[model samples]
Target: MVLLKARVPRAVALLGCFVLISSLLTLTTMAQTTVTSGGIGVHILFQTNKWVTPNIHYKAGTGSWTTSPGVAMSASNNSEYPANDGWFQFDSSTATSLEFVFNDGVGVVWDNNNNANYKVSATGTYSVVSKVSDFKTGDLVRPSDGTGYHILFQPITWAKPYIHFNAGSGWTTVPGNAMSPSTYAGKFSAANGWYEYAISSISTVEITFNDGNGVWDSNLNANYVRTSPGTYAFVNQNTATPTTAPSIQGYVNGPGYSVTSASETAGVLTINLAVNTASISTSYGTDLSALVVTVTKTETDSVRVKIVDKNNKRWEVPKSVFTTGTLGTDSSSTSDAVDALYSFNYTQNPFTFQVVRKSDGYTLFDSSGISLVMKDQYLQVSTTLGSDLSVYGIGESTRDNFKMASGDKQTLWARDQGSATPIVNTYGSHPFYLGINSAGQAHGVLLLNSNGMDVTMDSGHLVYQAIGGVLDFNIVVGPTPAKVVSQYTKLIGRPKLMPYWSYGFHQCRWGYGSVDALRTVVSKYKSNNLPLDVIWSDIDYMKSYHDFTLDPTNFPQAKMAIFMDEIHASGQKFVPIIDPGIPDDNNDYAYTKGLSMDIFIKDTSGKPYLGQVWPGPTVFPDFFHPNAKTYWAEQIQLMYKNYSFDGLWIDMNELANFCPGTTCYDNPPFAINNVNSHDAIYNKGISTRRIG
Candidate 1:
C-alpha cells in the first residue's frame, strides 16, 4: 500500500534547505544520544521547533555538557510526522542546576533579549518541567501602585454596563462604568460615554465591559488592552442611538464628491473621484486625496468594481488566497450604461453606483443611497439591499444555523477566542459571504483585505467599514447557491478529502491521564464491540502539559510505545493534539531550535510577540516565515519517532493568545480601539482557550 505523500514541491522544498545543512553540520559536534526505555521521565517536550534534527545541548551549572537523544527518523521528509504536530524532547536527569539551550548545527540562537538563557531550578528534580512560553515571565511586570486610566464605551445596545479588569491578580469588577450617552451623532462623530479606572503598577491591563446581565461587550476574545499610559478613551461611534427613520450615515446624502474623469474601454469603466477631505474629521488621514474607481466585467453575470487610493499602496492578504485572474474572458458589450447581461448606473460626484442583473433586472449591489467614505486609514462602503436578502459566511465567527438575519452586525477579525460563544471572532478568518435574494438567486462577495473591520446588515443595506487595506473584493454571480460556492472554491483553494476511517467512530478528550487509563478506555471499547477507528488525547499526555514530553509517571515512554504498537496492531489509530505556541524553555530542545531558526512572529518592536496560551505564555510561529515548511517538517519527524501516533490533532490555531489586544507584547499595527466604530475590530487579537 502506498502511503500519503506530502504535496510540497521542489520549489517550496527549499524552505528547509538551511535546516538540512545545519543538521548535517551539527552531527559531527555531537554524538547520537539515545533514549533508553527507562522511566526517568522526560520533563519537557517542546513543539514548534523550526530546526531539522534538533539536539538538546545541555550543561547544568558548570558541569559536563550533554546532548539529548537523536530523532529516531530523518527530519528531511517527515510524511509520517502526523500532519503538523512536531516536537523535540529533552531530559535533565543528572543536573544540579539547569541552564541549557538549543543549537541547530549553528551558533547559539538565544531567546528574545540579547542571547538570554532560561534558567531553572533542578535540585532534587530528575527532569525540569517546562510549559510553552512566549516571554521570559519576567518580561511582563505590573506595579504595586495605582495609576489613573480612562476608557470610552459608546455601546451599541447594552444597559447598566460595568468594567472588569485585572488588578495585578485576576479579574476585578467595578460597577457603573458606562458614561453618559453622546449628544452629537453624524458621519464623523458620536456621543462620548466614558469610564475611568485605577490600574496599579501593572505593565499591561486587560478589560471587558458587561451589562449587569449575562451580556458582555468583549470584542473578539473577551479582553482588550489599555496600552498607552495615563488617561485615554476608546470611542464606539456606531452605537445604536434612538433615531426616527435614521438613514445610514456614510452614504451620499446630497451632491457629495464630483467625478473629474470618466471613460470606458473593453467593457470596463474608469472614473476619478474628487472629494473634500476637510468635511471628515474622525478619519485617520486628513483628506481623501486621490480616488479612482474601476468597474470590470470579469464574468458574464459577475462584475468587480474597485475603489482605491490612486498613489498610496494598501495592505492586502500577503498570500495569494484570493482569485487573482479573471474566472473567464471579459464578455464584450456596447451599451455605456449596460453590457454583457449586466448594466451599471452611477453619479459623477458624491459617487453612487448600482449594478443590475440584465436577465431579471435585479439589483445585485447598489450604493446610491449612502455616501462612500474613503479615508487614508479608514474606508466605508455600503450598498442598498433587498428586504428579503439572507446572507451567510463572513467567517471566523459563529451565527445562528449558518444564516445572518437582517439588522445583524458581524465583526471580521481572526482571533484565538473559543468557538462555543456566539458573535465572537473564532479560529479562522474567511472574508467571503454568500447572499441570497428574495427570488432565491444566490451570489457571493469576497473582501480580499486582511485589515480589521465591522460589517453590518441593516434593514435594507450592507455596510463595510474597513480600518485599513484597500477596498478590493470580487462578486461571484450565481443564480444558484451551489454555483456560487463552486466559483468561490475555485478562487480560494478547496478542502482536502479526509481518510475513510476518519469517518468512523472515534473517542477523544483532554484529560486522559496514563497509559493504563488509555488502555482501559480502548479495552472497554473492545468489550462493548464498539467500532472505534481512532483514540485521541489532548495536552494532558505531556509532562507539565508541555507539547512533546509524555508524563513519566502516567505515560512512560516504554509503556506508551507498547500501547501504540498494540493499538496499531489491531488496525486502530491513535492521535494526539498539538498547538502552535512554543513555550520559551532554554532547556527544552524545541524552543532553542525555534529561536535559532528565527521562525516566530515578531512584534511592533521587532521582537518575538509573546502571548499567553494553554502552555502559559508562548511565542507563535510565523506560518508565513520563509522556512516555515522545513521547520514544521523537521519537528513532526522528531515527534513521530518519539511517539508513533497515526495522526496529529492541531489545535489552538487562530494563533490564540491569552494576551488581550491592547496589552500584547507586540500590538498589531493600525489597531482600532473603538468597539462601536464602523472600522472597529480587535486587530491582532490573541486567542486563548483551555485544551479539552
Candidate 2:
C-alpha cells in the first residue's frame, strides 16, 4: 500500500539537465519578482527564500496524483526525486478561475481517478517547476517509468477531458477522461487510446509508474511544445519494452541586449537583431532613435517572451515592446501579418523571436529553447496604435511602465456610476458575481493551490483569460451557465443544498432585538406568504453573540437546537451570519478554546488580532491561513456536533471593514484594492451572467 515518493525539481527532474549550468541563458533584464494582475494580483520571487524547493510542474492538462496522508508526492519528469510527476491545469480558456482571483489563473487537481479534490488556497502570481523527484512512500512517479501521460485543454467543453494511460497493449491513450461534456467520472474513450490528450495543445510529456515495489520512477521530454490550440496524442515510443531513459541537453543564452532600430513613424520603429519578450508588458531602451515617442505600449501573450537570439543570447522581452491590434486587425498572431500589419507597418525582427511553452507559460522555452520574434515595428503597423500602446492578455496588468499604455493610460474604462446610489436592489455579497458571455453561459474556474487569495477581471475586460500561475484554477467552460456551475462545484468540493426557504426573501438588519420584535416580522411574512421565508436573527439571539450559546436575559429557549427546530418545523430554513472575527474574552468558551488550540490568526506581533467587530474586539480566524481554516471548519462540527447548522451565512468576509468597498493593506490579513480585485470588473459594452 505504498503511495508516493519524493520531490521533483522543476529544472533538474522534469527537464533533466537539458542544458549545462553555464549554458543557462543570462537575462539582460531578469525580473526580480514576477507579478501579474487582473481580478487578483500575484507576485512570486523565485530567487528568494522560496528557492529551497525547486518550482513544481507536470505535463498534464488538469490532472493530479495523491495518496493517504503522510505519503510523499511531487511533480516532475526527471529521476532526481524518488517520485515525480503530478501537476494539473485548467484555465478559463478551458476550466479555470475566471470569476475568482481576478479571474486570472487556472485550476489544477489530482485524481484517485476518483472524488478526492483540493483547490488553490492562494490566488496570485506564483511559479511551479516539474522535476524528477525521489521515492518517499506513495504513488507519485517519474516520467522515465513509461507509465504514459495526458494533457488536456478544451475551451468549449468541460467534463474531465484528459489524455490518460491504458495498460493492456501498447502505450494506448485515454482521452475525454479529463475533458468530458458529461457528468460521469473515470470514463474512458476506447476507440482511440488517447494517451496524450489535448483540446488545444501538448507542451511537455512526462509520466508516473509502479514497479510492484515501494519505489516509482518518472521522466519527461521537455521537447513537447504546442504550436496551436487543439488536442494532441503522443504514444510512449518506449512502452512495451524497458529502455534506458533518454537524456536531453540544450543551452541557455541571453538576458539583455542592444539593438539597431529603423524609426519611420511617431511611435513605431523597427529594431534589428535585438530580442525582447518580457518588454511586451513593459518598456525598455529604444533600438530606434528619436521619432515622436508620445506613447509606448506593446502586446503579445501579455508576458515576457524568452527569445534565443541567433547569437544565442537569452533576453526577456517586455510585453510593451511590440504594438498590437485595436478595434481593427491583429497581424502579429496572424500568418498574414505582412498584409493587415500595414496600419502600423510591423515586421518580424530577423534576429529575435519570442519563445514560451505553447501549452502554457509553465516553461520558458520549448525543448529547443527557440521561437521566432514578431516585433510590431510601430512605423510599419497601424496608425491608431503605437508603442505607447493599449493592449491586454491573460493574468496581465500594468506597473513600472508595464501597463496597458504609457503614463498609466487605458484604452477602455467604464463603470456603473449613477446619479444616485440605486438603493440596494439586493444588498448582500453574491457569491454568484461571475461573468457570462453572449450565450448566457457562465463557466467555472477552479483554483488549484491551497495558498488562497482573491482574483478579479480587468476594469473593462470582464471576460479575460489566465494563461498561467501557481493559482491553478479548474477551468469549467460551457455554453450554459448551469453547466458551468455544476462542473465548477466538483472542482472545488461541491456545496450542500439548502432548504427551500433559504431561497425565499427575508428581512434582516442588525437591530431586531427581543424574539417578539423578531417574531413580529416572522408573523407578517407567514400571514402573507408573499413568497416570504424564515425569521431573521442578528445579535440579540445570542448570549453576547458568543456563539454556541444563548442569551439568558434575551430568550433562554432560543438556543441552537430550539432555533433550528422551530425553523425546520415551519418547512423553512434558518441562516445565521458568522464573521471570521472570533471574540477574544479569555473567559469566553469559544475564544479560550480557539486560543488553546492555537488556531486563531496572529498579528505582526504573532498574537491574535483583537479587533472590534459585533463581537466587540475579537480574534478573526484567518480563513486564508490553512491551519486556521481547518481548525475553524472543525470548530463548526464542534458546535454543530450537538446541533447542525442548516445553512451557513459568512459575513464580514471582506474582513468586514465597516468602511465598505475598499480598505488598507496593513497588518496580517489586510485588505488590498487594485485592478486584481473583482471590484475592478466592469462591463464596457457587454452583459454577463452565471451559467452553472
Candidate 3:
C-alpha cells in the first residue's frame, strides 16, 4: 500500500492525509467493477516496416514469454512506419489479474518500461492496445536485417531524394556528378514506400537528407553520428501532419454578454458589460467583478477594439517594442465626429458587430457567426473574410511564396527550426496578417498579444486561439497593399535603417576554419572581381564556440586584427555571429557580471536558467530584465576592445536551448502546457519538435 503524505501547516498536518486517504478509499469501494470469466482479448501495435514480417508473442506476468505459435503482423500502411498501427486480438482464459508485455518473435527487443505492463481483470470482454516504439536514429539494437545505417525520408511525390554527407572526406552529395535519378543507380531505393538509403561504415560523420530543390532536414545542433563501422538503419521517419486549428465545429456561444451601458465621446465608444452567465469564468489574475469594451476610431479607414478586465491591469506588449502613441480626439460627444470611411453596427445581446465600407457598403468584418470568448488564459475571436482574399506577412516561415494559401493554419510560436524547413514555425513570431480583398483593396489586423497561439484561415473565416493576454487588435484599411503596410508599421515601430554597405553584397558561411581560410576566401572573391562588400563569420571563429572569445590557435587576436585592418584598407568589413549564450564558467567575466547583476532569466525556483548551446552549458540573458541592456553592452564592449569587429550579427535570440525548457522548471506556467513551445534533447533521437 502506498502511503499518501502531505506537507501542511502544523495544526492540520495530523489530519490531512487521513482525511484524504479515507475519502479516496470510500470512493473506490463505491466504484463499479466488471467480471469476465470466459476470456479476455489482448491487442498490440507496432511499426510495420521495422520488423520484417516477424511473428509477435506475449508473456503474462506469471510465466516466461512464449513464441511457439506467434502471430504475424500485417504490413498494411507500412508507409506510415512509426505511426503505422496494426493490432491483433487474442483470447486469454488462463490468466486472470494478468500483467503482460509484447515482444518480437526473435526475443531480442521487448516493449518493457517499468510499471508500463498492461493488466487484465477476469471481467467481461477486455482488450488492450499497445504501441511498440521504433529504434533510435543510429542504433543497431533491434530485430534487424544487419544493415549498418538505415536512412528513410518521408516520401514526397514531387522531388527525387538524395543525401549530402561528410564521411571522412569533405562534404559532398552522393551521386556527385549529376543528380539524374538514373545516375545514382545502385544507391537509391525505396523501403516500405519511403525513400531509404542504407550504408555500413564507421567515421565521425554528419549528414542531412535533401530533395532535389535545396529542401533539406538538418537539426542545427545535432545530426546523425555513427562511430563503429557496422550495419545500421535509420528507423526514424518524418510525418507531415500539419497542425490544424482546434476544432469548434459544434460549439455554441455559452451565453449572451449583455451591454449594460454605453457612451460615445470624442470618437471613442465605451461600453460597460455584465457577463450574463456566472458559469463563464474569464478572470485570471483577479476576480471578474466587471467587464469593459473600448472602441476608438484611430483613422479614417481603421478602428481599434480592446476588451479587458474592468481593473485595467491586463498585460500587454511592452512599450519599448510598441512605440505608437494613441491618437487624441478632435471633438467631444458625437458619433458624427468619427471617421466617415466606415460605419459600425452592433447588437447588445451576446455582443456582435459588423464594419462596412461606407462607399460601397462592402462588409469589412462580421462577427455574428462565432462567439467571442476571453478568459484569463484563453481568448477566441473569429471574423468573416472575403472568399478571394490574398493574405501575407506572418513573419518567419520558410515558404516558396509570401502569400498564405486558403485553409493554411499558422502558429505564432517562436522556435529555433533553422531556415529552409518549410511548413514549420521557424525563428520569429509576428501575430499580424495583411489581407487583400477581391476589389484589390487591402486591410491589416494585428493581434497585439505575445502569447503563443494558432491562427487559422478557414475558407472564409479567420479564427484566433491564444493561450493568454488580453484580446486587443488594431485594424488598418487601405485601398492598396503598400499603404496598408505603412499604417500597420505605425502601430508597431518602423524597421531600423540599414547602412549603405549593408545594402551591398554580404557573404556568410558556417565553417570558415581559420584566419588563413578567411583570407583565402577574400582573395578568391577579389581575384574573381565579385562584389563582396562584407565577409561574415559563424561560430567557428570563437574559441570552443564560446561567445566573445576568439580561438587563440586558429584565429590569434593579433593576426585577426591585422587581417581586419587589411580588409578595411580595401573598403571592406568583417562581421561575426554573436550568439546569446554565456558559458557558466565561474571565471568567465561575462557570465560572472550577468550573474552579479541578476540579468539572466530565472527558472521556476528562481535560479538562473541553464541551457546547452554552442558553449556546452550556458545561461541566457533575460532581455526583458531591466539590467539586460547594461549587462549586454558591457559584454559587447569587452569583445569590441579586443577584436574591433566592424559589426555584430545577433542570432539565437529566440532563446534556443538544446536542453528542453519544459524540463527546466519544477513548476512551469500551465499556459505553456497545451501550446507547442518546447523541444527535447537531440541525444534522445525522438522528433520532439512541435510543429503546432
Candidate 4:
C-alpha cells in the first residue's frame, strides 16, 4: 500500500492511498540464504537458413522471463564450433541459473528443446545441440564452398524485388540492386518462387530488401545481420493480413444535393437543399434528405457559411464555448452577389459555391468539381486550389515544413501524443488554414466544428471530411497575408497580452524535487549571473502528483510560503504545474466537492469516469459544467492561500487518459485518419460523444 497525503488550503487535511496490495504467503520450512556470483553463457547450434537471428528467452533464478521473442543472439565464431553450422551465443554476467528457450525472433517459430526447455545450474559456456548424438567439441574446418553470403527472398506480391546490403564495407545504393529469379539447389528454388542475390567478395553482410520504390521489407525494420557466409532466407513476418480496407470509401464521391430554395435576409443568405435521389446512396450513413445552408456575411472581410440538417437534430457547438463576432447586415437586395469584399455564386443543381474576392477577382473558395456530402455522422466539403498555391496551418500536428505539401492530409483530432510523433494529431486542434495564391493574394479558412476530421490537401484540391457536426466555415478574405491574419484573429478573438515578466528569461524543469532545491536553483542563477525573472515547477511538488496539493514532507506549506516570499523579494515570480485529474479519494476535498457539485465527467453507467494518471485512479473535471468553474476556482484559491504562487502551468487538459477502451458512446460510422479507426474514435482522449 502507498499512502499519499493531501491538504485543502484552510483546515481540512486528508490521507489517501493511491494503490493497495495484500499478499498471503504460506511456508512449510525456513528459507535458506545462498550466495551466487559469476556469469553464464550458452552456445546454440541449428540449421543456418531455418531462422534469421535466433532469440533466447530466459529467466534467471526467481526472476521474470524476458518479453516474447526475447533478446536476439549474436552469431558466434569461437573456433570450437563446427564451421558451416549456424552458431549463436547468449551471455549474462550475473545470472547463475537460467531456464531458457530459443525462438526465431519473429515470434512465429520456436525451439524450446522439445517443449522441456534448457536449464543451467552453473556458470560457464554450454554447447546446445539438437540431440545428444550430435554433441561434439573439436576444431572443425569449413568446406571450400563460395566465400560469400547467399540471400534468398520470397516476396509475397512484389513484382520487382531489390536487395540493399553492406558487406563489411559500406551500404549499396538506395533500393540497391534488383535480384533475379533463381533455382539455388539445397536452398530455395525457382520452383518455390524465390529471388536470389549473392555477394562473392565479402564473407559477412548486413542486408535489407525493397522494391525499386520506397516500400521496404527490412526484416520488420531491424534488418538482417549475418556473420557467416552461407545460404540465408529473408522472410517478411510483418505483412498485414488481407482484409477489407477500412470503411472510408465512397465518402468523397457521393451524389450531391440540389438547391430547392434561396432567400437573403439582411446579409444572411439561406438556401434550402434537397438530396439528389437519381444516384445510389453511399450506404456509409443515413443521408439527411433535407438540409439548410446559411451564408452569413460576418464581416466586411469575412463570411460564415454553415450547413446543417433541416430539423437541426444533430449536435452543434454552443456559442458559450467559442464566441465569434456579430453577423453583418450590409446586403439589401436578394440578387446582390457581391456583398462588401467578396461575392458568393453557386450552381443550383449539384450545388457548389464559390467565394470570390471583389478587389482582385480571385476565387478564394470554389467547390465546383465535387458535390457537397452531408450525412448524420459524416460531412464533406472540398474546394480546388491553384497548383502553385502555398498553404499553411491546419495544425496541432508536427509537420515537416511550415507550408503544407500537396499530398498532406491533416487530421484535426485533439490527441495526447507527444510532439515528436510527426504528421499525427497532437494536443489542440485548430481547423483553420491560410492559403497564398501564386500572385501573392492570401485568404484564411476556418472550420469551426469541434469534431474529428481529415483535411486532405492533394491533387490541387483542399478537402474537408468530418465525422460529425455542421460545416461552419468562416472564410477571411485578405488582399495580403498580414491583413488575412489580422482579420482572422479578429473573428476568433485576438490572443491575450502576456505579462512583461513572461518575456524575460525563466527556468523550468520537472526535477526540482523540494522547496529547498527550488531555492538552490534560484540562488545558482543569481550566482552564475543569469538573469531569471520567473521559476516554474512540474508535478514534483504535488503530493503523489495530485493537483492542488503540495507534498507535506518535501514541499512543506510553511517552507514553500517562505520560499515564495524570498522569490517575490528578488522580483521573481513562481508558477507550478496543475493537471485536471483529481485523485479519486473519498477523503480528498477536491474530489468530494467536485462530486457533490456534479462537475466530474460521467461514464456510460452515469458514474464518475475513472482514469489512471500519475496519482493512480483519478476523475476528470468537466469544464463544461456550470459549477465547474466555481469548484476549480475554490480549489485554486485554497492552494494559493497555502503557497503564494504567481501563475499556473495548466497541463494535461487535452483530457489525456491512461485507461483503454473506456468510451461512453458508440463510434461514428465515418473514420478520420487519426492513428487508425479504433484508436482515433475510442482510445485517443475523451470520447467525442461524451456530453459536458
Error of 3 at 378 (Å): 2.2
Point out the worst 10-residue segment of candidate 4 by lDDT: 20-29
Model 2 scores a TM of 0.34
- lDDT scores in order: 0.56, 0.31, 0.58, 0.69
Which candidate number would show the highest TM-score if scored against the true structure? 4
Runs off by more than 4 Å, candidate 2:
1-496, 529-531, 557-567, 624-630, 633-645, 657-692
**Candidate 2 residue lDDT tens string, 364-434:** 11112222212111111001122222332212112222123221211111221211111111111111222
Task: Between candidates 1 and 4, name the one with more favorable TM-score.
Answer: 4
After TM-score superposition, the amount by which residue 129's alpha carbon in candidate 4 deviates from its true location, in angstroms, is 42
Quality of model 3 by C-alpha lDDT: 0.58
Model 4 CA lDDT for position 670: 68
- Residue 357's lDDT within candidate 1 is 70
Q: Is candidate 2 or candidate 3 better by lDDT?
A: 3
Find the 10 residues in a row with the least total lDDT in model 3. Answer: 20-29
Error of 2 at 432 (Å): 11
lDDT of 3 at 14: 24
Q: What is the lDDT of residue 338 in candidate 4?
A: 53
Better of 1 and 2 by TM-score: 1
What are the C-alpha RMSDs, in order, of all predicted structures?
A: 17.9, 29.4, 23.7, 15.5
- Between candidates 1 and 2, the one scoring higher on lDDT is 1
Q: What are the TM-scores, per candidate, against the unseen true structure?
A: 0.59, 0.34, 0.61, 0.66
